[model samples]
Target: DTTVKQNPRYKLARVGKPVNLICSQTMNHDTMYWYQKKPNQAPKLLLFYYDKILNREADTFEKFQSSRPNNSFCSLYIGSAGLEYSAMYLCASSRDGPETLYFGSGTRLTVL
Candidate 1:
């Protein structure tokens, strides 16, 4: 199985503090994606990487930051945690498109 793994299945963050979540895969997929999900709402695509190129959703692009320091690793960074930031963060990887995405279990962040 080409699995995507996320570190820290659960997180607690103080309001206004920064939070960082990590994802990694050994498959060496060309593309990696990060999504934010909330109860009763669809998952929102935050950002993605096609090789070394980063692409972010224009509407939420400024809300999150990410980096793929190397092919096997990627990280999602939130500069300031807020009450609304409490949600599930999902990391996925695919060779090209969403059709073949392999998703990590997710990290649930709770902002206090």
Candidate 2:
């Protein structure tokens, strides 16, 4: 596989509840990323895993959290869902830093 998978193509959460999204890739890529996209705005990088290393965007460090359980799987977790978090969650993979990313179709999250 090109190396990336996300579950629940779509999700709806109540405000203030926790939310978790899953992703996987088979390419054995060491670097995987998660981004949040909204209408009229650029996809914002949230966090990523470089092998066992984890990096979160400076501005988003506190807004989002992620973990890579293994080379083939990763997940993003939001402690408290909010309307502002309603957006498409994109999972991507790259061999290393600044490389082209292979993205999943994306998981659309809606907060109510």
**Number of clashes in every candidate structure?**
0, 0
Task: List the global CA lDDT of all models.
Answer: 0.94, 0.91
For each candidate, what TM-score against the reference? 0.95, 0.94
User: In model 1, where is the ten-residue run with the lowest total lDDT?
Assistant: 93-102
Q: Per-residue lDDT of 1-112 in model 1, one digit per residue for the tens?
A: 6889999999999999999999999997999999999999999999999999999999988889999999989999999988999999999998865467899999999999
Clash-forming residue pairs, model 1 = none
Stretches of candidate 1 above 4 Å error?
97-99
lDDT of 1 at 32: 92
lDDT of 2 by residue, 1-112 (tens): 6847899899999999999999999988888889999999999999988899999989888878888878899999999998999999999999875778999989999999
